[model samples]
Target: MDGRLRVVIAEDAAIMREGLTQTLTRRGLDVVAAVADAQALRLAVEEHRPDVAIIDVRMPPSHTDEGMRAAREIHRDLPGVAVLVFSQYIETRSATELFAEQAGGVGYLLKDRVADVGEFVEAVSRVARGGTVLDPEVVRHLLGAARRADALSTLTPREREVLALIAQGHSNAAIAELLTITPGVVEKHVAAIFAKLGLAPSTGVNRRVVAALRYLGS
Candidate 1:
């Protein structure tokens, strides 16, 4: 928390870019650059040499896995830079693509997390510090893949409560409010869920959404 981390943010949406930048800045992290497209993201990373890159999982010109590809390149060219990916949905291929590069120093979280600036910033810091952070939603999707065997078995009752909230796309604060628990307690539950599912925190949320649909579809 003492040493500020340099960060580059890339999102195709303008409002999201601005909001994220302002939020990160308010949290005392240095947003070295903010861009709207994949090309701009590449250039921004090259120019800024940020310690971390907080990127949306999709961007133009194709708006399909562009951010994941850019992240791959950054992981290759800028090994020191971590990436935290945000997404509205989770698809299996997307998750495979992002982590296919390098799992370390990466994060995948749902866009809903943005509502809780405190938790979002904490996730950013975790990735910057070369630790993984995955949205518990992603973990539920992964665990759900286990079929009727009760995908929920991997967690304690408390963690199951957290995962159920996550599957509903609830924010940590929202989950805390619903359960009459503290956000910190929710975080512990989330951590437990992630460990049981073998999901790194940085697994992109969109990918998890895809996984969830697939798991739940059956």
Candidate 2:
């Protein structure tokens, strides 16, 4: 988690895959393998055992959800390998599926976000270190869908912002800094969130990931 991360890229498009490899390489990450289709992605991950894998949501041979499926398998089989699902659409269903079983070391980001090289790179590193990373757009879509849920409706405006940041995989300190509030206040808000959502307190679980999963309706 401290040094350079090894990565595997899975995308159907050659241009985008190569470009991403070049970008990640330039950013100091070692691209162990870059492959097309979900099958190859799985094979590459198995062979390289990279720290993280960058996967496109759609891939070859009935491309509807091949990448998402592969991501789920990779996460299930190799718990240590982080997965970042890259896609052009929000695809709330796929997003929900990715976080269904686990939340840490996983991310869902839109392809358009790649334009912001720094943020994209940060997302990769975040997941590589067992942190969640949900794109703002993906978060918005999930939150929008959950608007009818009674618990979500009860959230105050400030609480809603804090929850959104938590869904973005931000730590208490990071959320506090981003929202320009004290860390103690962030902790209070998180406690309130858990209480309001009725999510039982558990020592082993990552609270941030739990909040994100709730937001995603997983």
Candidate 3:
């Protein structure tokens, strides 16, 4: 706690960008960079390389998918950086596409989460360390969609527990410790969960688990 968490704020609105910068800096966190568009946002990340990046889902000329696009690039270029996306609308498609590679160092939450500074800061710190934090609202929608497809029923009792943990974005070791099981058993259960969900094997850092998340999300 002696040192501050380095951070960047990217939002299309000047006021919002300023507010975020001021808020975090007042919290003893460093506002290393702040940008108003995706392009600047990208450069700031590579140049300043903050511990966490808070970006608005809508930004720039298009103001549609720019934020999400920037987020993907940040993951590709700086896999260690945590990108927390704030969206006014819950875009399930954006959430699903992110799953194509599987969420890593990412948090997709509604913009409202930032209103509660304590909770918002906690999320930022969590994601910066490779943890995934999804908005509860997003989780509810994903779980609901999956239920309609009967995906939840595919899990065994144990598998279901594992799936819940996956949705919570816990690592295999953490899940094992939480459940008092061996890491190997957690791995096996995760693999089984992915297969049951009909998602192909993953290609990213947290692939299989992320694939399983697409189902748990339902």
Candidate 4:
């Protein structure tokens, strides 16, 4: 994953698609192909085998779940290719379904993120490098809707914030930087979150992913 990576975009809105293409190109990424529908997306990915694919949550014919289905297929068939599910609003079901049984090299971002070219590009790159990038709003919504809300009610506000950041795949250092707190304090919050949530100590499982699953009621 060196040099400018090849990208494939599948978005129905012409203006939005073109804008994305221009932005990625301007940022030194090569837009190998930009298509409008799920079929075209599959074809483009199969033909180009790009490093990353930016896909919408809906498109063309049915305009419902087509993009999501295509994204899942790409993730299955092209393990090396990173997929970013870009949408206007948070769809909890879609987000959970996309991450089901897998957590690496994936991202779910709101379209508003496109306004900040730096952040958007960094997200894409992070996904390309086998890292996860979840939208903060998505995390918030899931946290707010956690099953057995009482289970999460014990966490302090600051501890809850740390849990959400962990779910977003941010390291303690990154979380500290964003929250302007010392890394040691972040670790303390993380410990408090795990304890409050009653998550048993484990070595094989990712506690962050577990926290997210709890939020999503899984």
152-194: candidate 2 lDDT, tens digit per residue: 7788899889999988878899999999999999989989988
Candidate 1 lDDT, 1-218, residue by residue in tens: 44788989998888888988998898899988899988999999888789899877778887788887787788777889898878886655556556666778888888975577898899999999898888888767655544422444656777766666677777889999999999898878776666566556564555334323433443
- Each model's C-alpha lDDT? 0.76, 0.88, 0.79, 0.85
Error of 4 at 130 (Å): 0.7
What ranges in model 3 sit over 4 Å off? 99-102, 113-115, 144-218
Compare the candidates by lDDT and give the number of the best one.
Answer: 2
Q: After TM-score superposition, what is the CA distance of residue 63 in candidate 3 from its true location, in Å?
A: 1.2
By lDDT, rank the candidates, best first: 2, 4, 3, 1
Name model 2 segments beyond 4 Å from true. 147-218
RMSD of each: 15.7, 15.6, 14.7, 15.1
TM-scores of all predicted structures: 0.62, 0.65, 0.63, 0.65
Model 1 CA deviation exceeding 4 Å by range: 142-218
Model 4: per-residue lDDT, tens digit, 1-218?
A: 65788899999999999999999999999999999999999999999898889999889898888898889889877988999999986766667767874789889898875568898999999998888998888777655555446777777889878877787788999999999999999988888887777777898988778886665553
The best candidate by TM-score is 2
lDDT of 1 at 168: 75
Ten contiguous residues minimizing lDDT sum, candidate 3: 208-217
Model 3, span 1-218: residue lDDT tens = 34788998888888878888887788778998888899999999989888889888788798788888888778767877788887776766666566446576788888765568988878888888778888989888766665645866777999988877777888899999999999999999987877676666556556555555565545
Q: How many steric clashes between backbone atoms does each model show?
A: 12, 0, 6, 0
Clashes of 1: 12
